[model samples]
Target: MNAPTMKTELMDAIKYDEPFRAHAIYYAIQQGYVQIDDPYNGLPADMDYDAIKKMQHANILQMCTVKIFTIPFGQGMHAIYLANCENDARAKHFTLYRQHAQRIQNASRRMDVSLYCEETGTHEVIRETKRRAAEFPWYVGVVGW
Candidate 1:
């Protein structure tokens, strides 16, 4: 939109995108198509050189994480059948009154979880190489939504 906003976005893009920054921005800087203040004096007053440099880290420590969702089932087969049954309100109420109360619960307890991924999803550490495995342990993970 505005010049300052676009500049900030461009700076963020160069910071987060390793390949693009390495090839394009670095090349442009080398060829004198673009210029950068080595001391980061051109940056906003709130940002320091070290802070910007920290944001430019291509490879940083990743954390291993696993999310286990526990879903509780509120009803059983009888409840499902009752819900699907085509009956009058009074008959359904009578049938429900005669049936016993039921509850279903499901959960995942303690389990081994090992695998780490970069916070930005740029690096997926699946192998136990020099980097410790800490994220995305599931071989084929999928996002439900």
Candidate 2:
């Protein structure tokens, strides 16, 4: 499948897990993987920034480095693994994965905007956000490919 198709599949998988979708969307926005189209929507957008931030933090903790005190996954377990090993390997791997995940989150957020704004008369904001999201590889190359 092409990139856009892959992105949509990923996003659909994420949406199937509702909690994960919320966490991912918030994380994406916080990390600047996605930019808000217009901040001047007259009324505050539906997002609860504080709640989203908390969710993002929790999601990161769940997916990234395990607490040092925790036991490591045993051999033959299907734990997520990083391929390349370099100095600061764990940190680097988490960073890269987070970045990519955030992009997917951002795209999902844009999809939400597209779905909701029409009813709210925020078409301008929707249009702009869609345009920007489409520029991202996750959206343009992978989402609908």
Candidate 3:
């Protein structure tokens, strides 16, 4: 198939597996694979630095990653035509479809996404400590992406 279609299929497959998706998302965020809007850039003059920083960090947990691959197959042959194998199903399909073909070429792109999860438990202790300091019902916000 075409690049866009292939990407969607691959990303959808990844999304079908929740654990993998979560890991990918966390990894992407830690690596800064996604970019968040600069809250301070267009903020009103009255807004202070702390508010801008909080806004920026609040959205930094969002993550996205794109993977692209090139496949060479015969004209009119698509990946769906290939049989799915137990081992490396997607790779098997690609290899079968792209056999000694020179003219027809295609590329696949996949984007993976992950949203923030407050109950991740990684920073609960620190969050609780900060909340205690505030002497109110609050949790420390996510600090590092």
Q: Specify the highest-lDDT model's number.
A: 2
Which stretch of 10 consecutive residues in model 2 shows the poorest summed lDDT? Answer: 136-145
Q: All predictions: root-mean-square deviation over Cα?
A: 18.2, 19.1, 21.4
Task: Sort all candidates by TM-score, best to worst.
Answer: 1, 2, 3
Off by over 4 Å in 3: 1-70, 76-91, 94-145
Angstrom error at residue 108, model 3: 4.9
Between candidates 1 and 3, which one is better according to TM-score?
Answer: 1
lDDT of 1 by residue, 5-87 (tens): 32343465444433333333333344454464332223233324353344345322211122222222233212211111123
Better candidate number, 2 or 3, judged by TM-score? 2
Q: lDDT (CA) for every model shown?
A: 0.31, 0.34, 0.31
Error of 2 at 108 (Å): 23
Model 3: residue 133 alpha-carbon error in angstroms: 44
Best by TM-score: 1
Q: Residue 97 of candidate 1: its Cα lDDT?
A: 54
TM-score of predicted structure 1: 0.21
Predicted candidate 3 versus true structure: per-residue lDDT over 1-145, tens digit per residue: 3333323432443444333333333333344443222221221234344533453445333322211222333353322211112223244443554444232221211112122336774433332232234332121222222
RMSD of 2: 19.1
> For candidate 2, lDDT tens digit of each residue in 26-69?
45456655543423212224556676667756765243221111
